[model samples]
Target: ELERMNQEINRIGVNINQITHNNNSALYSREDKHRLYVFLKQIKTLVSQVQERL
Candidate 1:
């Protein structure tokens, strides 16, 4: 169970990283800038979830 949790944490971390990377891209205010904000928020949420679960 611990190992499974570890793997899940790692996977969520990777996903959060990817979202951060995408969110870190150059600005685009004219387009869907909200997407970046949403992604970053999701990253924060996921990180919190991982921390709580761990």
Candidate 2:
């Protein structure tokens, strides 16, 4: 489970980097921004859970 979570966190980090790259090329639409926000929230929650487990 910990490994899975770590992988997920890494994946999410990559996704965020992609989003930032896209934004630099051209600003993201409201929907895209919202999606990014959701992803960030999920990452935060996952990290909190992992911390609690530790």
Best candidate per TM-score, number?
2
State each model's CA lDDT, in order: 0.69, 0.83
Q: After superposition, how far is residue 52 of candidate 1 from its true place, in Å?
A: 7.7
Residue 42 displacement in candidate 2 (angstroms): 3.1
Model 2's alpha-carbon lDDT is: 0.83
In TM-score terms, candidate 1 sits at 0.49
Candidate 1 residue 43 Cα shift, in angstroms, is 8.0
Q: Write the per-residue lDDT of candidate 1 for residues 13-32, one digit (tens) a residue.
A: 78767755665775346355
Residue 25 miss distance in model 1 (angstroms): 1.2
- Which parts of model 2 have CA positions greater than 4 angstroms off? none
Which regions in candidate 1 have their CA more than 4 angstroms from the true location?
Answer: 26-54
Could you tell me which 10 consecutive residues in candidate 1 have the lowest summed lDDT? Answer: 23-32
**Candidate 2, poorest ten consecutive residues by summed lDDT:** 23-32
| Backbone clashes in model 1, listed as residue pairs | none
Cα TM-score per model: 0.49, 0.66
